[model samples]
Target: MNRTKLTPLDAAFVQLESPGVPMHVAGLMIFEPPAKGGADFVRTLVSDWRKETRIAAPWNQKLESPSRWQLAPCLKTCQDPDLEYHLRHLVLPKPGGQVELGQLVARLHSQPMDMRKLLWECYVIEGLAENRFAIYMKFHHSIVDGISASVLLMKGLSDSAKDRKTSPFWIQTAPEKPFQPASFKMPSVPAMLGAANNVLKLFGRSDSLTTLRSAPRTPLNGPIGAQRRFATQNFDMTRLKATAKTAGVSLNDVVLCLVGGTLRKYLQGITALPTESLTAAVPMSLRAEGDLSPGNSVGMIYSIIGTNVADPVLRLKKISQATNVAKQQVLGLEPEMRVPYSIASFAPAIARMLTGVSGKKKPMFNAVVSNVPGGRDDKYLRGARLLHCYPANIVFPGMATSFTCYSHAGTLNVGITACRDTVPSMQKLALGMEEALCELEHGLGLEAHANPRSLDVVEAAL
Candidate 1:
């Protein structure tokens, strides 16, 4: 723990070789407290964050090998507020609610996290439609992922709001002990020779890097404008699952198909779009059950979102095909290789810092559409019911939009994050998502709980 070297996960975050890459993933929540108690909510979160940081193990230590990674936490219950930042939460002007929320989110996408501290932030926003409020949090993607992220959120919320327990998040229930990084074991002579031979073979074959380079040169891959856009939507997971089950696929396949339908409709709104399906890069977590002890365990797949197709069921089939191909490509990559190339790792930290000072090029995705797995169990906070959890991911150039969902209490909370100015009428994209979900449900002859529409989608375009 005395060293200052980057773990593989840390290296991925610092050396963002990918373009339009979001540094961290975040979740936005709208809470309806019974009454406004000044600083009560903030105090609760600060207290929780204080306890959480005590267990946060930084990735500054050496590992037994490049493949092994882990994090270590201190005992005696940490109370370090320095581990997190309390961003100023500004209430929007009159009538400015989700509209302004979208604006702030767009601004956030354009900014980058500081490398000096662990990348994380928590904001408490006041003045929603009425007495309700909101909270937004961002964390470096190198840590836990969306599903793992939701687990942390659920854990923070008390099962009983009035339980009045004095448990430190740093200390686990039935606590075994804090984890320490395992020692690194250098490869033996035979293993080293094998890896060296594989590298030479790959150099001559060029099979691994071709699929990544084959990404078409679109506006989504080039330089980006500073201005951003935001869009969101919520859908019925029950319906999505039913459709996916009927199609002999997964809810993920359903999401891929539905988004394909939505994008095709969106393009038709603009003008005649290409017949070739639009490509999307879906990130895949490489974390095994025992891997989350340290930093990031992740990779990505580049595949066609299947946007050009016109049929829902047919589109689902195509999406399934593309996904299989993409997954195969990712599996074919070298185990030690990361999703984004790490050429910058060869330079000093300062040199790597300079790359993002202005902007780095070489984006790999037109738009990212990820479907994170979420819990199906119901969860709550101190008396306050956990209604919804909206996710807002950070943005990079060429790729300004992304999608994610969390399943809690038999309901699916689908979240969207996008660039404001660059994307056209993103709000409708949100509404269209509802409409698309409904269409999907209706197509499958399944029942839905409600037909609630996503806030005013049309007005936002103005």
Candidate 2:
């Protein structure tokens, strides 16, 4: 059997899975029909996909044992995967716009994937008003992190629109390497002692920037229901870059500040704004350059998102400072120690979840915000133009909100997923994000672009 064991970090995702929280990450992609294709384009694509019953690695693999924390599930390649079960064809109702698309995604994302089969599913959706089709595919976090999954998705696409022979993402194959177990190794005695000391210093520090208990209690930190509400907002990459340049910070810093400002506005609107700043758990990819192998390679950093500050420019400065401090602390550690440090830092929260004390204790962070890079140039699948790709990520038990953004083809696409009951009118937050961006630009004395190029038509249709 071609088998691979899940790493402790990856296995934790399996352990944390429950009826309320589904530990899966997904991508929602909108594609324009090719010039030569007719009204039956998406149907033809589905027919071609269903004809190929042979599945590929990862997608064709299932758990060796049930994924309980006690059983420690390992993945073994299976001979057959039910194509009909893994792939589905759906049609959007009436409006066929982003609003309707988001509604459909929220419902689909709320349902958990059956662990007995492959831990992935893809939906080919047609009937979009503008004649565009959409694809929503999700994979368990144990199989791939955001970067690795993005690489796999990109592999199924071509930079040239004229390239019509591109294969589907699942069937792409790589040169087989000898199977080395994916389990985490116990560190050497000396390394173990060093890691212990490092963890203590990382968590024991009293500095406001480095302390683990710096997160503020907000409405966003609470027990969540099974249902989820998802919203998306698009931004012009050029305007964002200009803001980053003016502030002398990275684009991610600008994004953090924008989200921070939006959260402040939303909370104030609901009369639940926290007096102190809220901390965010920012995810950092630990994958080596060009290392697109499947499975998780992620670490976490805590940043003060500057929610307490009302001035957008100053808020961005504080966020940038906090992020830089957190990055420096992580960079100070050896590459091998970084992941362990992150796990250690997050241990308290995980313990709370396991002990059924999740929402009763202080949160490690108020929310999660992740930024993933996508293809800078336009992408095409069998000559169909790729418009935008938005990411939907996991929200933990205590932290009920997650914001994941993807930058593709000169646009920054933001996806907001939250507990449906706790976060009301989720679209308000999405609109607030747009307002925050404009506010930031105005505060920086720069002109803000009206709207992202790709979202104009979609918004009009909505």
Candidate 3:
């Protein structure tokens, strides 16, 4: 708190306002309450915050780390009533369905979190599908991301239904461990000087050249709108995984290929898909070992997902290769290598700021696709069973469609969030994804891994 620096939490606002951006800083969590106690779960979280000042902002004004961030609400409360932070509280609306709860979540996201304090909120949802309940948390783009959010929520929730009745589910992560340290031990004078020299040397090089190489012009990235559209889909992760294994690619690659295939079919002969591999900004987790909390612990990796290829299986192969090459390029760079480029954001010229704010950014990637790996087993809130968890991601302008997938217990839930105006037929795209995925399975000669019966339920609803 004593450190003077512009924290990553604050920088997020600057990133959000930028035009031609596809990323949305938000997350959704689903919970199944045990038969006996649910209120205690909420009570525990509130009590934990009271004991520690968890709200903070990153002090690395140098911008060395993303997760090693700071928070707000530093002053301790003097009164019990006023002591409670309204941002953290209980939400029990008159009995309504899970879809109704979704409507409420949508409303919360329509408004941005205020930077004056802790820019995050948590909603305790009841009346969910089946007997399960849900908890939805929204943190500023500057703070926690989907991966960190998942880790923190798991620790907050009960390991067993009986555990839900107890308070202090887990210790809080305030003053969380920094996202990274230069090293475990002090380096020799020569080594330290060498590291510093490397940073200075990179700064000496033409920053504009490297930054320009990363920026690509495409239809995907642009200014986002205030309104967001939410869609949910379920895919057989097992089938997808098996297909990927057969193809010697990753689940992510398979999914990326699916996006390309579906888009090609949907937009065939309309705009002529890109001839080269399409790019994607992959958000990688920066959190070290056990330091997980409710704040941003993420960084960006510009990836070129292969949409240039036409064949489904061939596209998968190309995507996996392109991603490997892109990640290698980024990883090979020094930590401070991106500093000069980020500094360009603070340049004073109105033309420069306007350029970052309003123009159609050169395509860094074709679209944004992220897959979060979660539990493949079922979880309970109190006594109720969780039926489904639908995700609604934030939407910016040009890059309208964002896809996030997570699995819990035995089910894989995929959330497709986009701009209604841009992806007007996103529901159809969701269906197309299913068909594409099946086509992929067929391509790999795998029939045993067809979609589950639940696919019927989703298709019927459509």
Candidate 4:
């Protein structure tokens, strides 16, 4: 196959990647044994996956110039990658549970990928309790964002539990479309006038761009080490939806509120909580519906999460108001201007990461909070019921933590990835999230819901 040039954004991901910051995104999926359970269920699946010698696009693609931390000219397909090297099998140590699983994922996420080969790996991990095993797959972010990566991982599953003929994800071909810039459209005269009016009004608002000149320098924004800490939390969709309905806000608004409250509590415990409300750099996807072209296509918006407010209900209102204004600013811009606006919005943060001045200066935002959609149905792989799928993403210099969540099968799965050393006892954030949710419910005069299990083991093992 002919070599294809990497998009500028994709190349930037590769060029900026380092041992301290591996630019890859991963999904951890735990599965229940088939109705006719067998001890070798995961082993058999791994053996079957090994036999599929043929590989597909993106999985088969690699940097043309194979050099770590160096710019690559193009991406070329490797006709055959060593299947044994790419597909791995492992077992958790004694008392295999959430603590063990989180530790293993953090270790794996910290290791950089081999640039000379295809940029992906699949692991079949066994030995969890309750006769359940897991499949963890990671792909370089240069090739796929969290949404696209989730799509690829779930594409090879079956909706029916009885179906046992599902193929491995790597063998399936990706959509053939290449990355194309969004078409530029000339704004109508009235629309342009309206945008100008909105800009004028935004200057008077407290959550305006002027307010976003710099983020509060909290412990979360700092240089990171090679090691990481991964934590998972899940919530029932019914309760969150009901809360959103009762509060007359979008589900996302409630989610940001939950995040704000969680961070507020955690920071206060450390006595490092900034006096000012923190800002979050939220990722907004640029891909239109049905645009499955591979590579990164996302924008950014900064929202002020009301950390200063002690009242949960009031905090939610402040966050919703800030986020609405930020969204309006982005949506008000013309199509062509949106990308530039996003770039400018994040340029300072990117500069900090590159120049190694991350914690030394004010951050662009305190953290990155991203939300992606996972399918609504229970999916299975060869009749193995997919129970939980949690995301594990990257944490670059300055941004010590990332909160990425996806809704799957009537639940919301949140993955908190952080620098192990920088954010000590990171699992506290997981437990904090639960407490914050309940607090919000009570503040709204709603009955508290049962909290989902999130592996609240003792402090993290070194």
Clash statistics: count for each candidate: 13, 0, 39, 0
State the displacement of the C-alpha of residue 97, model 2, in Å, after optimal TM-score superposition: 1.1
Candidate numbers, best lDDT first, in rank order: 2, 4, 1, 3
Taking every candidate in turn, the Cα RMSD to the unseen true structure, in Å, is 7.0, 3.2, 7.4, 3.1
**1-462, model 4: which lDDT tens digit per residue?**
768888767777787777778888999998988978577778888888899888788788988776645655589988888988999999997458898898899999889988777889998999888878988898888899877788788877889998887788887777755666887677677666655554444324353452445478898887778999999889999989988888888888788888889899889988999888888888888776687767888867778777888998898888888778778777877765566565555555665666778766667678888889878899998898888899988888778999999889998999999998998888888887787789999999999985847445435522
Score residue 53 of candidate 2 by CA lDDT. Answer: 62
lDDT of 2 by residue, 362-383 (tens): 7778988999988789999889
Q: After superposition, how far is residue 184 of candidate 2 from its true place, in Å?
A: 14
lDDT of 3 by residue, 1-462 (tens): 243333444354434443233223555565555555455644554565557433323211112232312232122211222224433454545565434554566555565543333344556555544434565665555444676656554544444544433332223333466566565454456644544443343223222211123434545455556655565567766777788899998777787777767666645534746555555555555555676554555544444544555567776776687666545444544544333222322221123333454335443344557776676555554443445555556555445667777666656677777664565455555666777777777777878454553353353235
Instruction: Put down candidate 1 lDDT per residue, 156-265, tens digits, no spaces.
Output: 56665454443433232221124556855655666555445433432232322223333333434444455556666666666677778877877777777766677667
Error of 2 at 44 (Å): 0.6
List of clashing residue pairs for candidate 2 = none
User: Relative to the true structure, how large is the alpha-carbon lDDT of every model?
Assistant: 0.55, 0.82, 0.52, 0.81
lDDT of 2: 0.82
Give Cα distance to truth, residue 2, candidate 4, Å. Answer: 2.2
Model 3 residue runs over 4 Å out of place are: 1-10, 14-24, 32-104, 166-171, 178-222, 269-277, 331-361, 375-379, 384-392, 448-462
Model 4 segments more than 4 A misplaced: 68-72, 178-214, 452-455, 458-462
